[model samples]
Target: METIKISVIIPSYKPQNYLWECLESIQVQTMPQEEFEVILILNGCREPYSKAIESFISKHPAGNLTMLQTDIPGVSNARNMGIDNARGEFLTFIDDDDYISPTYLQELYNIAKDGITPVSNVIAFNHVTGQYETNYLTECYKHLYNKDKITIMQARSFMSVPVAKILSTNAIGIRRFDPEFKVGEDGLFMFQISNRIKILKAASPSCVYYRRNRDGSAINSLRPRGQRLKNNFKLMTNYTKYYLQDIRHYNIFFYISRLVAEMISMTFAVRGKIQQ
Candidate 1:
């Protein structure tokens, strides 16, 4: 049997209509089907959702696609399950609501190596407006437009999300999501993974991950300020602990300070909005 070069992990909970589009995008990737495998984990909700996904997989026929359903509700847990079952040498994550360009996988895979990871441009697509716009992540990509390779500090924004990057399995070995966090988990996970990666290669700009910006989405949904602050505290505490151990490998201090600054700025912004 041939080795699986990439494992695409997608975790869904009460997935919306967009899940089909996400699956469709992967099915049409330029990468050969045999070189990659798709692991779909339906968490929290089962039965109808699982049956629907299973039926779609059967009909669409993307080679090496596996669907797993778990009682766990969080995306982090579902992704952890996918990681445990993955056989590919490299792994990439895609949210169930978002899709990627046809060349996303192939472009990232071309530049990926043991100590080097590849980053792709992220495009924010407004589901309601049917418009595509540049987001903070896209700006981060532009910051490195002139460079071929960079460090975690250079592509700091990449640390915040797992999407739009191809990571070596060895780099991610034994590290899993901190299930306790509903927010900032991606950043912390990537921060941990960065310890093993020596450099990050910028993939072609054409390789894009279409991030859907819609109401009630994780990014758009607003939680209670107390909950947000609590999660933010936990995130900072975790980042601090890891930085103390791998201070030379990653500029985690930057993340810690920036997160604190963002929180302060956000509080002011909300206050200003209310005053107006």
Candidate 2:
């Protein structure tokens, strides 16, 4: 009956091979089992995945683990469902394919409890390559070393993409991932929330994000050059229109430059010039 401090929302889609490790990491958290709730959103997966998650939850009844199913098919919809059903003060998003350290929740909880607003840590490991990458915190510090006034937009612009970050679910208001975008949903979601919330960087490498390298993975399978370019363009336009509305002086130019950079990257990705 006690209130939970963190709600870990994992949006799973056909993650049978990887879900166990992800769940195991959460189960072994250094934080008290009572302090957090793990909510798995099984978005439009077949019975096998649902049964697997259900069985795991049944065995670990001591922890507050809940499995919810939705016929709605995208990762965005699944994440949005998790947000609606969450009962914790702070929310942390973990991909079904990634694993977190035992102290992940406790560290995030400590910062959030101290009123850090929106805080995110460094995500180590690229899910696609299965190799560790430099922590985002280190990257951010390098850009604005020993400087304050680290605005959300600046952090977001520098981070490039946002995943594996802990955020105050309520302070940013009840915002959900834009259901339309499939590829850049995380980036757009971060951009939208950055406008309203003050985000703090937790300088730690705590989360292991596994970037899937297989051909069948969502990122790899999305297809033709033209379609991919169109989607990326749409993502940039929608994100910019919603978040960066000030439109003054050189800031506008910088915003357009970032979007252009993203477009160029997408062009290379689609043309097989660079591997995403």
Candidate 3:
């Protein structure tokens, strides 16, 4: 009868061999099991993976893992289901392929206890290329090294991928993911949260957010420029609904710019596909 402090929502769909490692990382958190729970959503998975996961759960009954199955096709739908079933004070997202560090939960829990969205510096481990990426998100996050807490309004350019972050349940309330856009849905979800809540800095590098550069097996590897453009249009459509609601919303300017950029991208994508 322990009150759950953080609910680690892992929405997995046709995951890689690294999924077991991802679940294992959560199992070994320094934080007590009573203080946290892992909600592993089996998103539209078929036999072998589903059977393997069932067996995996049975062997490690001490982790307080809750398995929820859904025939829903998208990660957003899976995550929305997680939010509905979450019995925690806060929510943290973990991709099935990404294995976190031992202190990942403890560090995030410490910050989440304060009612702020905790964002940490992540190690983007590309197991395929054997390279660790240092993108613009990492570069901008470095600027927060001197501070402990930050207002999301001030740090608008901060990465909103829903990774390396923990958010309060009340802050997220009933806001479900827009399942239309396959790509950038996480970022869009984070942006909506940012508009609604105060974001804090937990920039200390903790988790190794593993990204495998595999072939068509990966969700990211399946899309082409045309597909990306179509998804971006869908993303902007959802974003525009939020944008028009309040023209004065803190990140409205960024939203408009993003919408315009998506338009340009769609144009290019259409022309490119036509030439093909």
Candidate 4:
């Protein structure tokens, strides 16, 4: 068997046919199917989801796909399973609901094989409006635009998403998501990876990250008043601890600012609940 050049991990729950469409995008990639593998992680689903994924795989044998089912919940655990099972030289993640262009895998693979990480243009597509957009985050990090090599400092300071980057398997070897964090887990994982490797941004937009305009479908979905407070506290504590060590600046003021910001956000959140 030919060595797998790339491994794309998609962790999904009951995403309906959205997962199937996401798989279709990969099926049409410009790269050779044998060179890359797709690992679909079905997290905490019963008969219908299992049946659906089995049906998807049987229809698309050219996908070179491997589907794994885990009874354990959470995207974190699902992703961890992907990391453990992957057999490719380079790795990247795509949300089950999102789809990429035909050139997505090939373009990023070309950059990554030469020992440079490749970050792509993330087009946030409104599933409802059928609108695609590259927002201000890319503009704000203009230094990374059209570049093939990026320093840790440049990567650290800029806001980035895992979907935007294809990383070396060696670079991400054994790095697992913190099961403790339901939110901000992906962010922290990216932050940790960028700190350890050189990342490059792909020249053009190649992925359509579908965002539906719906409540309860996002990471920040509103929770019950008491549960919300606990989750918020966990989020704050993790961020504070991470930033305290992450603040590379010598100035004490910047460190203090992060703490203050977290506190202020928490205060207003609780205040809003009280007022309600």
Instruction: List candidate 1 stretches off by more than 4 Å.
Output: 252-276
Candidate 4 Cα deviation (angstroms), residue 42: 0.7
Q: Between candidates 1 and 3, which one is better according to TM-score?
A: 1
* Least well predicted 10-residue stretch by lDDT in candidate 4: 207-216
- TM-score of each model, paired residue for residue: 0.91, 0.80, 0.85, 0.81
TM-score preference between candidates 1 and 2, better one = 1
What C-alpha lDDT do the candidate models reach, one value each?
0.83, 0.68, 0.73, 0.68
Candidate 2: residue 271 Cα off by (Å): 5.3
Backbone clash count, each prediction separately: 0, 4, 0, 0
In candidate 1, what are the lDDT values of residues 37-152, reduced to their tens digit?
99999999887798899889889775678999899799899999999999999999999999999999998898885356889988897899979876888999888765866877
User: Can you give the lDDT of residue 98 in candidate 4?
Assistant: 78
166-274 per-residue lDDT for model 3 (tens digits): 7788878777888976667776776676566655765456533444444454444444776777687788877777767655654765676567756776776666642
Best by lDDT: 1
Instruction: Write candidate 4's Cα lDDT for 1-276 as tens digits.
Output: 345888899998877767777889889888999888999898887678888788888988785898899888889898889888888888878888778778888887877767777666555556566675555445534557666666554554332356656778777766678888765566556555543564555546543333333334555465555655565577557655755664563223433443454466567667764211
* True-structure lDDT of candidate 3: 0.73
**Which candidate leads the pack in TM-score?**
1
Please report how far candidate 1 places residue 188 from its true position, in Å: 1.1
